[model samples]
Target chain A: MRRVAITGAGTINPLGHSVQATQQAMRDGVCGIGELDIRDVERLSIRLGGQVKGYDPDSRFNRQQLALFDRFTQFTLVAAEEAIAQSGLDFDGGLAAESGVVLGTSGGGLNTQDENYRAVYEEGKNRVHPFIVPKLMNNAAASHVSMRFNLKGPSFTVATACASSNHAMGQAFWLIRGGAAKVIVTGGSESMLCFGGVKAWEGLRVMSKDACRPFSANRNGMVQGEGAGVFVFEDYDHAKARSANILAEVVGFSMTSDAADIVMPSQDGAARAISGALKDAGINAEQVGYINAHGTGTAANDKTECAAVSNVFGHHANEVLISSTKSMHGHLIGGTGAVELLACLMALKDGVIAPTIGYQEPDPECALDVVPNEAREASVAYVLSNAFAFGGLNAVLALKKA
Target chain B: MSENVKDRVIQIIAEQAVLEPADVSMDQSLSDLGVDSMGLVEAIFAIEESFDITVPFNANEPEKSDFDISSVASVVAAVEQFVAEKSA
Candidate 1:
């Protein structure tokens, strides 16, 4: 069987615009969350968010392109550009026809939909933008990436809520490993930090007004974040042939469904997925040096994840380093796993484990070595990135040092 | 609390828990009635609509909410208070 290599990784998140900046911020344990300065801040009970600061689409995209691109699509394209550029592989002829795009997003073009809805209901307007449908569609980002990069094989978007990105990246990894495609631009992007977006999330009452402190006993809930993370998953031999810079190897991935609860996470479901990924990689739990936890800072998610980790790793639970970068960048929802995967890459390639910043008093229930609020300098071989979504969907990806 | 208000609130809670109003008891908590977190939120929404009142309940910190959901009777009392305040 063919192997997959992550040749390029890019991100435009709340922590920073580029992967380098994000890596540094994570290493320094920077808190990207703060008082959200959105359009309707006064209306939301949850005021704080990990909003992507200092980004202007006017400077990046042309007037014509801006009209067609939604906030999510724009973020995806920006990150995709960085990823494709880093990969140093020009898509032409055979490559262009084979390479594909797979992206994940829950609220695809949510900003576009929000504005149009506001115009119709609040403003009492009959007319809206012409490109609304094309811009707000779930597959818009994936289609745009494919069109921009001339990737023609299998292009689609997966929307499993928070697990979307991991599922997308896992599909990319398998596509290359199964000989369906040589390379796939796979990741996720989400821009749902708008009024309607946050307002909708507020209804669920799972948002934090102050901060996101995953694995902390005093943690309140998740803070919304907006951004994109993209990676080029290429065949190991193909990447090696071109002398490409291999960031990490995509060793294994496993997805599971609870089929039990709609919102609450299932411990058995999560444990199965975690152990399944380890089994898929054919690696022992002792070999796993780090885990980028799906720690959303909510009391339920944090405790459940800790239980699952403990169940899977047993006595080694306290040995392997684990942290949730979500505490730093906030929960990006659909795009979260893609951004968290960057932490796995960092752990494998850089040997510096990202910290789960904002950790306060640790709960006895969640008593695992959660790496706390400081980045650790640990030489790690295999690392796992976990994403457990609200719909009882879980996706775990295992990576190894390339 | 008004008898009608109490009966309506109990009915809402019972429906949320997938039980009959006769099966629901005033002393029972929402959890005792098998009303999960999502069910409670839905019940709260239904209560608001029925009584035309805004619930001050925050799912994050339920105990901190002015609207008590500890028992069926408490929820009815809270709803009646909110309804009276809205009318006043």
Candidate 2:
């Protein structure tokens, strides 16, 4: 089987608008969550969120492109451009035909849906934008990415709720490893902090009104965030042939379904995916130095995830340095795993472990190291990124330092 | 004010719990009526739509919500207060 190498990476998440900026913020323990400045803020019971503030599409794109691109799609293109530029692999002729795009997003073009819904339902308007259907569709981001980059291979979007990005990236890695595709522009993007989006989440009643402090005893619940993270996942030979700057190696991937409750998480299911990923990577529990946990700051998620880690790693659970970047960036829902992958890269490439900030009091149930409150320097050779969605979907990826 | 608050609230809760209004007891809490988290949220939405009132509820801290949900009767009283305050 061919090996997959993450040759380049980019992001425009709540913490920062680029990979360099985002990692620097992670290393400095900067929090990206604050009072949200979305439309109808007073109407939402959950006002605080990890929003990408000061974004002006007019400055970055033309009017026609802006009309066709929803906020989520715009984010995808921005991140993809950065990643492709960093990879410096010109997709021409055979390369262009062999490349593809795979992105994950739960609420694709939700901002477009919200605007059009309000126009039709609340304002009773008969007229609507012609691009509404294409713009609001779930595949809009992935499709736009293929078109923008001239990718001609298998291209699609994955929507597995919170685990969307990891699942999508796993598929991309498999496609590359199986010699199916030479290049995959893969990651995730989400813009679901709109009024309707927040209202829909509010109906679930699991959102935090104060702050997102994952694995903390005083934690309330998960907070919504918005942004995108894209990566250039290339065949190792293709990358080496071009002498591309490799970010990391996609060593292993595993996905599982609990087939249990829809909203509730299962520790057994989560533990299996973690152990399975390590097995797929041909590594032991001790090889994993850090883990970007699926800790969502809710009572059920934090303890359940901790139990899963303990179950999978056993005695090594106490030794591994685990942290939730969601503490600083809030929960990006579908786009979360993509952004959290940056933290893994930081550990592998930059020798820095991102901290779980806003961690005030530790819970006994989640009694791991957690790397609380401050970033730490560590020479991590292997790391695991975990994403457990609401619908019992679990995706875990094991990455090795390049 | 075509229907009383207690009767209407019971109807909504009964619908959420998938029980007949006759089987729903006002003294029973939402949990006692077998209204899970999703059902509880739906029941609250139904109450809001029926009474034209916002329930100021957040599931993360249900205990801290200004509107009470300790019992079916408490929910009715809270809705009645909001309705009255709306007119005032």
Residue A333 Cα positional deviation in candidate 1, in Å, after optimal superposition: 0.8
RMSD of each: 1.7, 2.2
**What are the clash counts of all predictions, listed in order?**
0, 0
Error of 2 at A267 (Å): 1.7
Q: Which ten residues in a row have the lowest lDDT in candidate 1 chain A?
A: A202-211
Ten-residue stretch with the least lDDT total in model 1 chain B: B52-61
| Tens digit per residue, CA lDDT, model 2, A282-304 | 99999999999998998788999
Model 1: CA > 4 A from native: B1-4, B20-23, B51-53, B80-88
Q: Mind giving the per-residue lDDT tens digits that candidate 2 earns over B1-87? A: 625887898899999989999999878989998998778889889988988988887665677788899898888888889999988
TM-score, each model? 0.96, 0.94
Docking class of 2: medium
Query: What DockQ does model 1 achieve?
Result: 0.52
